[model samples]
Target chain A: MAENKIEIRNLYKAFGKKKVLNGVDLDVKKGESLVVIGGSGTGKSVLIKCIQGLLIPDSGSIKIDGVETVETSENIHEKMGMLFQGAALFDSLSVWENVAFVPLGKGKMSKKDAKTEAIRVLRQVGLAPDVADLSPAELSGGMQKRVGLARAIITKPEIIFFDEPTTGLDPIMADVINDLIIESARGLGATTLTITHDMASARKIADRIAMLYHGKIIWIGTVKEMENSDNPYLQQFITGNAQGPIQVEV
Target chain B: MLKKTLGTFLQTLGKAPLAFIINLGYFTQFVAKSVYNCFMPPFYFRLFGMQFLNIGFYSLPVVGLTTLFAGMVIAIQTYSGISEYGAESVVASVVLISVTRELAPVLSALMVAGRIGAAMAAEIGTMRVTEQIDALITLSANPFRYLIAPRIWAAIIVMPLLVLFGDIIGIFGGYLVGVYKLDFNPANYITNTMDFMKSTDIIMGMVKAGVFGFIISVMGCYHGYRSKGGAQGVGEATTNAVVTASILILIANYLITELFFAR
Candidate 1:
């Protein structure tokens, strides 16, 4: 397998008049956890969505395992797993079925086997096997995040994408989720890319941190490098200050 | 830059109709494939039953009330118009054929289209916005097969049944109006209704219901499948699905009526 699990080059997307994801280039290496940090609506979600072909880029090249990812085709989706910003669990499906979704239909596994495996994956994500019967609606926000993580990892995908995994939880729940994300990524030995604005969660989960601003990664380095960097945009973000080179549109 | 802008404008002008044609063709294909997928295996009898309840059974009260009042009003009006010609006895035949062959199915369709079509659009549209469709795709589930097929199948199977129910209830409403208001013998009214409605009329009406069911479900699924923007987009799709389905049902009703009854 190649070193890079995903390589996105010079991605561009625009929505009518407003430009989003202008010339974004990113690479996540195999079995590595890379976290992307950017301000809200700065195209971080759009960038990852383009990579996933949920939103196609106007012009760019996205490759997974060196296979050019204009492959929105059926063959390519089988290899991908994503944890969306909102968890995006199907309300119509039970928790265990949601986790076992891919395995049931894709692998053509019998229902009994899929259920057993769903409980196993849920347990791996620190969920009780009994939690499997509850609807996603019945779970707490943090528990939902765990279930989402369970679903994301159940398929043992070569690559996984996390969009704002820690957004809506309390600080304590956020940290728990961050730890679970790390544990899941490590357990699977999967290439993981997470986008977030939470510095604490990013610091805990990211092996290397990349800062996205104005649709470009202005700085990318180790966590230590991130703390010590002189880049103005990253500094403004890490400090959470109003007065800086970064301007929030009023 | 100016030359590029002009060239772009020209290209857009050329492409606009092409885009419309492409979308139109896609919609027709969506409808066609949905019909074909309806009868294939993994028949999801449970979901189909739930949707039958939604599309046909749950819709009974509205469809029943609407058909009752519509038949009543048609009776009242037909009596008023032809009474000058002393053709009032024909009112029974008029309301009977009208309700059975035309008004009941068409009105009930438009009503059910608003209710069930909007519900389908909103359900599927919310699913779209939340990436539930994407989730199914990732699971290697054919979303069209899972979602659209069951709904279209339920609509086809249940709509005819609903129309049959609507025809009976609506004629009863006319019977009630005719006996009480016009003093026609209730016994004569019953026989007149039986004489007026034929096997062919019932079959043709049911066939129209099936066609309308296909149109309504297809529009809802197509609009929901194409929904974008966000919740607002979903709302817009819900509204548009009803509007488009209602209009198509009327147009198709006319065409089918012409096909079955033309001189």
Candidate 2:
């Protein structure tokens, strides 16, 4: 693999008595896109949370650039960025302030300079400079997602995480977000890990896809392998079939 | 009947002591970190000003009114109790000492604990639920320094002053009762209050108020800082902060009283 930028080995997590992330092992190569797909409640979110240090895994080794990060995710995460599912923008700060959050911390840039750079980052994500002065609440769902994506890339970190990037968008909006995701990840040459079940999004943005079912990564392959895989779990999920060893709830 | 009884038994059996231990561990860690950060660099006075407006200035009216009524009732009760000994002239001095040393600070803390402490818990608990706290931490700001420190500093700074303000108003409330209602000699009332009040009583009340302030701030921040779930969780934290703080203030009042007056 291209000198594995992100490596997870035998990762496990659980909440209360129920185990999630039962021995999840995956790797994302340098500058490549890895998308994890799963039905809801398959611990996809929990896995990303473990990777981001938001949730502590029960047992695992998550190494970024060959450095074990289980004990130091907070320190490790400075080189990483995340776009949460809800876009989880700070309602108290203006759009530019949210976009410029990390830059404001470095003490290397003045507020005036940070504002300029925030506008520049927003523009790169297809948002106008005027929108930078507004709050996240003033934007539509798609626009908020854009703002979130702008924020995730503004720091130009080595890795970016998208949690269900296209869950609540219209088909056209979803396509727009997908294009933004591809463009942003490519422009920065940042390794990206996205979690979603949107088949179209998976096809458009994933270089490699992993399907998570029953708290384990069941299948993983490139997009071409995804289309032709004979694995029943992969087929049942991709076709959204009701009869292939997967039961429907009422 | 058997199924319902078994279900209740299972639910109770499920809750072990581990969660409380987890919560206590987090609480102690937060308190230690807050104390550490309180002495650290990058103190923000601007944020402290906003919290002063929140915890002290906004809380004055309620404290003032509650203490006033409290003093009035104390005056009337002392007047009745000492009448049995024909020592009604001791009413002014009694009211002054009790209000300044015990009633003003303890009651003011309880009132402010109910108002500001609960509001702080609810506000920060909501922030915890909404990821605002995580956002702050990610921005390289010390959450304790930015959020908890301003609150702790404001409470410690403003509460003694609130107690002082309350003492004056409460003494005045007693004046109204003594001079107008009971027809005690106005000159004797003023002289009695001026003669009997000691600087130790005032200073002791101020000291107690400051400690109570720290307790209220810590409890509010502790409960709220660890809040989970959604809106309902925030509401429960607010309620718990108020209830626990009020009870603590009462217990601490007794302890402080025994320390000061037992000898």
**For residues B6-108, what per-residue lDDT tens digits would candidate 1 score against the true structure?**
9999998989898999889988898777777776665666677788888988999988998899888988888888754544458778887888899888988
**Residues B227-251 of candidate 2: C-alpha lDDT, one tens digit per residue:** 8999989988998899988888888
lDDT of 2 by residue, A43-105 (tens): 999998887777789998999999888655457767888887878788767999888977876
TM-score of chain B of 2: 0.91
Off by over 4 Å in 1: A71-74, B1-46, B84-89, B228-231
Reproduced native contacts, each prediction: 0.53, 0.20
The top-ranked prediction according to lDDT is 2
lDDT, residue A213, candidate 2: 82
Of the candidates shown, which would achieve the greatest TM-score relative to the real structure? 2
Give fnat (model 1): 0.53
lDDT of each: 0.85, 0.87
Where is model 2 more than 4 Å wrong at Cα?
A: A71-74, A247-250, B1-22, B41-44, B84-89, B185-187
Model 1: which docking level applies?
medium
- Candidate 2's displacement at residue A125, Å, is 2.8
